[model samples]
Target: MESVRTCVGCRARAPRAALVRVVAIDSQVVLDERGSMPGRGAWVHRTHECVDAAIRRRAFGRALRVSGSLDTQTLQNHFQRNG
Candidate 1:
């Protein structure tokens, strides 16, 4: 069976390939394009809507199991550059 993960933004359960993996490192949220980051990770749709939703809901910290604010510039830049 295919692996499934829920989007932290939309909370929708979807195939692993349908979502992007993210990891928190040093209070910054980074996109794990290869899905091989070594830590707790969160998944979200590739769309901006979902990304913004996750930010609005403060899902990153909760999903990554971090206890403080996270810098998402890298994540935002990735979307802006490649979205």
Candidate 2:
């Protein structure tokens, strides 16, 4: 069976393949396209609404267990380009 995860943004359960995995690296929020990044991960939908909600609610830091602000510019750029 396919794995399932919850979207931090929408707080909805979805198939793992339908969500993008995000990891914290050096206080930066990076998208793990391959889902193989070495760290704790938070899942979020690729949609702008979801991404925005995640950021607005400050879910990344809480989900990833980080203690500071994280830079999500790269993640936003990625969605903007691919969206």
Candidate 3:
């Protein structure tokens, strides 16, 4: 069976491997490609909209329980870097 995780933004459950694992680091969000980061985790779909929504809604901060906003450009940069 596929492992499942809940998206902190929409609170939707999906296959864990289908989600991108985001972690808060030094108040910035980093995409955990290996899914082995040791910190609070937030999950979002790999789609552009989902990622944009998550950043716009500060879903990572909500999931990581942080108190600041993360720039959406970072997520875009990540996708460019990873894609």
User: Among these predicted structures, which one has the highest TM-score?
Assistant: 2
- In TM-score terms, candidate 2 sits at 0.96
RMSD values, in order shown: 0.8, 0.7, 2.1
Candidate 3 TM-score versus the reference: 0.81
Which prediction has the highest lDDT against the true structure? Answer: 2
* Candidate 2: clashing residue pairs, number: 0
Model 2 steric clash pairs: none
**Each model's backbone clash number:** 0, 0, 0
**Residue 74 CA error for candidate 1 (Å)?**
1.2
Q: What's each prediction's TM-score?
A: 0.95, 0.96, 0.81
Q: After superposing candidate 2, which stretches have Cα over 4 Å from the reference?
A: none
Question: Over the full model, what C-alpha lDDT does candidate 3 score relative to the true structure?
Answer: 0.78
Q: Write the per-residue lDDT of candidate 3 for residues 1-83, one digit (tens) a residue.
A: 88999876566899998788988787778878898999888888877667767767767777788886764567768776666
For candidate 1, what is the TM-score?
0.95
Q: Model 2 over residues 7-59: C-alpha lDDT tens digits?
A: 99999999999999999999999999999999899999989889889999999
Judge candidate 1 against the unseen true structure and give its global Cα lDDT, from 0 to 1: 0.93
Off by over 4 Å in 1: none
Error of 1 at 48 (Å): 0.7
